[model samples]
Target: MHELAITQSIVEAVTQRLPDAQVTRVCLVIGKLSGVSVPSVEFCFGPTTEGTALAGAELQVEQTGGRVRCRHCGDEFPCDDLLAVCACGSVELEVIAGQELLIRSVEVRNHV
Candidate 1:
């Protein structure tokens, strides 16, 4: 699954950032509309980090809801899914947030 690949990439990036550090936790910001499977990422984390500095590291995922601003009525509201629209029956909308997949931060201990 792509989660494996994504997890591997995340591990690599974090390891490169902290070459001699022992990773403790990775905090990720996942948008609800981003289509990323949180469970799959968690499943792949252990395997991808095995034998690496990030071994035994914890994965923390923060999910954000979808939001859109209506162009017609200038109203902002939360959307249940990726379909960006407003209740005012307006198809034109500008997304304010919730379409992001970002690595927010990492907690690590320096190797002694």
Candidate 2:
């Protein structure tokens, strides 16, 4: 799965940023429309982080709902599916939210 590679990259980046720091948690924000599998990413996390700074780190995923702005009606509303349309029955829309894939935060332990 692509999540293996993705998880590996995430681990590498966190390790690079923190160096010897021990990562405690990783919070990931995922959009509902992004088509990424949260379970898949979680499955790959442990293996990808093996022996790295992120090893044993808690993986937190926040899923965001899809949102789109209706171009014809000038209304912004929650969109839960790909076939989004405005109340005016116009297919033209501008996405105002969702469709995001990002690492929101990384928590690490403080060295005494």
Candidate 3:
């Protein structure tokens, strides 16, 4: 699955950021409407991190609510649909959340 590739990328990124450090845990902010499945990502984490600095690291995911901004009412509200419309009967909407896949923090141990 693509989650494996994504997890691999995350491990690579963490390693690059802390070349000499050993990753203890990775904190990710995943949006509800981000089109990413939590179980899928978790399933790939272990395999993807194998042989990497974060091999035994813990993967922590935080779920965030999805939001959309209405163009007509200039209001913001929760949105579950990717193409969620505004309550003001406007189809023009800007996604404010639930479409993010970001590493919020990485805990690492000093390389002694």
Q: Which stretches of candidate 2 lie over 4 Å from their true place?
A: none
Assess every candidate by TM-score.
0.86, 0.87, 0.85
Clashing residue pair totals per candidate (backbone < 3 A): 0, 0, 0
Off by over 4 Å in 3: none
The stretch of ten residues in a row with the least summed lDDT in candidate 3 is 79-88
Model 2, C-alpha of 3: deviation from truth (Å): 2.6
Better of 1 and 2 by TM-score: 2
lDDT to native, each model: 0.87, 0.88, 0.87
lDDT of 3: 0.87
Q: Over all chains combined, what TM-score does candidate 1 have?
A: 0.86
Model 2, range 38-91, lDDT digits (tens) per residue? 899999998888888888999999999989988888898899787877888999
Candidate closest to the true structure, highest TM-score: 2
